[model samples]
Target: MSDQRSVTRSDLVAYCDAMLESSAFQDYCPNGLQVEGRNQVRRLITGVTASQALVDAAIEQGADMLLVHHGYFWKGEAAPLTGIKKKRLKALLENDISLLAYHLPLDVHAEVGNNVQLARLLGWQIRGGLEPANPRSVGLHGELETAQSGAEVAASLERALGRMPLHIAGNDRPIKRIAWCTGAAQGYIEKAIALGMDAFVTGEISEPTVHSARENRIHFFAAGHHATERYGVQALGERLAAHFGIEHRFVDIDNPV
Candidate 1:
């Protein structure tokens, strides 16, 4: 069913790992080629997470590999394959579908990174990293081409990401400077505040983040984690497909959280 040509699995994995610079960052899970399937891949599927639903979808699509931002084997998770994890792995293995994942490395990529892709979709101008001293800073600070109210910014995010972001207004003034990190990066609000950003945007929120936003007088937006991270893997997949002349499809398994 795939119209695209096939490429060796090793070449595809090597190219992705090198492009993402997976070795540069210490991450919770392995960066690339988490599981091996066929020696050659013709059709590839990309998603935000490798959940059971996503695995099932990939199998249905006849995907040779399932590439994602979040995959199995986290730092503290039990080693045994059981419960939901067991089912997910079983589906992939039985279907002969490879699983490839990248965590912080995918976050820090300048071109196809989640933060950069979000900015591209939302039209934010990138100025620099949240932690400028660290080469692989996960968060970024930037400016809006034109100043807009907190409410207006929220609207833009809702339109672009197709999800209503939880906005916490800290001030009445218009917002020009902003900082953002995708996927459960609410903790980086402090870094944004230290940079004197007018607002901070990230996926997922904690109770303390509200107090910090109110006290620090910076607007906060908790966009859904799955929504924020959806773009990077898609972008990476598209790029790989273009480079290798292989079929690529981004199957979005919606996650409200």
Candidate 2:
């Protein structure tokens, strides 16, 4: 730790807000300090994505602050806070719970980002972002330290994450080059296919993604978004806990992918 005074929850939020440049992007939902609760937070709760279940658990646990990788207010979602959205917000507000959300920022954070963490866990070395134009591209492409067969890679994913990946083998080729984007990034399968990757991995899958994988001759793996995303938030939360000497618990609400 630095010689400076220990940072508070607000200080952490401020640091994250500044680092993410939250205000620069037109976000669907409010970023940083969504629901205000205790002025000083001592215990932190983290989860893969902020679903209603997560909110309820945090409230039940009496968490001082809640951190999540996915949160409310996504692009193209209805702006009106009327139905489920209203209910979710009301739950937080009623409990006076503080909500901290990090999305793309956390995904591309180099060290603690979801992609980086996944790569490390799977023994892949990231080369660069899939999209070169955007510096903060959420999708990452990389290669394994040593090539493994498709089935072998599947075993690695299953063993590491406890979720058997839905592997769509495009070829009998040994797996070497792989592209990954955690959390509902099936849209990028074609991009991975274009990159000549032996396989593409993501947290979730869509109907068309399967066909695309077959047609493009790129292996596809749906590794469960919740499973893939659990790493980054937990890493970040642990860091914050150590930095502030606060209790941190990563709450997992399993979602079958």
Candidate 3:
């Protein structure tokens, strides 16, 4: 069992922050060390969100620290902790389990970022960032090894993510050039359209996205937010575990959206 291995909370946080370059990204939420818990971590738990369910799972697993892609204290949120936030923080504090979270940093990290990991998972090679100007752009454009129909692309996404994706066919052309970003990036379809991608994929599809896709004649796919973001955190957890020689487990909270 890896329980015998342990890592100091400071060391773990430092390693992650350095590896992810957390300070570089302008993010909605604060990255790294969201909640303080135990000083020494032996078992680490990772998940997509630091929800109440995930917190409970970490506690149940006897995790010394919890790492996640989504954490608390988003910009413009209420400064005072109350209700669900209070309850979740209380649980972590009482159990002495530290909470570590990364938002845009994890999403944009080159090696373990969600976009890159998704590409690796789907067997597509990235051609370039969706936004050519921004070196650290969140959305990316690429082509599948072989051209496939829009339905075939949706089927491939469903198979990879274990959830059905909503595919909006704007064109009948086989998908060759594709652009994608994970988690509620439907608005980026405009960029994809501007780039003349055959299709665009993201976690959520907004109302305007449908019309934009149809009008622009570019296909759109809304894969699950949770499903697409799963790989990066898991990859981060596995890396941390290997580096620190600690036991790591990824707890799934079954978010279908």
TM-score per candidate, in order?
Answer: 0.98, 0.90, 0.98
lDDT of 1 at 183: 96
lDDT of 2 by residue, 1-257 (tens): 24423346678798777766766655556667766776777668999877899999998888778898888777787789998889888998888778899887787777788999999988888998888677777889999989999899999999999989999887788988989999889998878877788999998989888788888888899999888988988888888877777778999998886
Q: TM-score ranking from best to worst? A: 1, 3, 2
lDDT of 3 by residue, 87-204 (tens): 9999999999999999988887888999999999999889999899998899999999999999999999989999989999998999999999999899999999999899999999
- In model 1, the worst 10-residue window by lDDT is 1-10
- Window of ten residues with lowest summed lDDT in model 2: 1-10
Clashes of each: 0, 1, 0
After TM-score superposition, the amount by which residue 125's alpha carbon in candidate 3 deviates from its true location, in angstroms, is 0.8
Per-residue lDDT for 1-257 in model 1, tens only? 54658999999999998999998888988889898898889999999999888899899988999999999899998998888988888888888899999999889899999989999999999999999899889999899999999999999999988999999999888999999999999999999999999999999999999999999999999989999999999999999999999999998888998
Q: Per-model C-alpha lDDT, please? A: 0.93, 0.84, 0.93
RMSD of each: 1.0, 3.2, 1.1
Residue pairs whose backbone atoms clash in candidate 3: none
Model 1, residue 36: C-alpha shift (Å)? 0.9
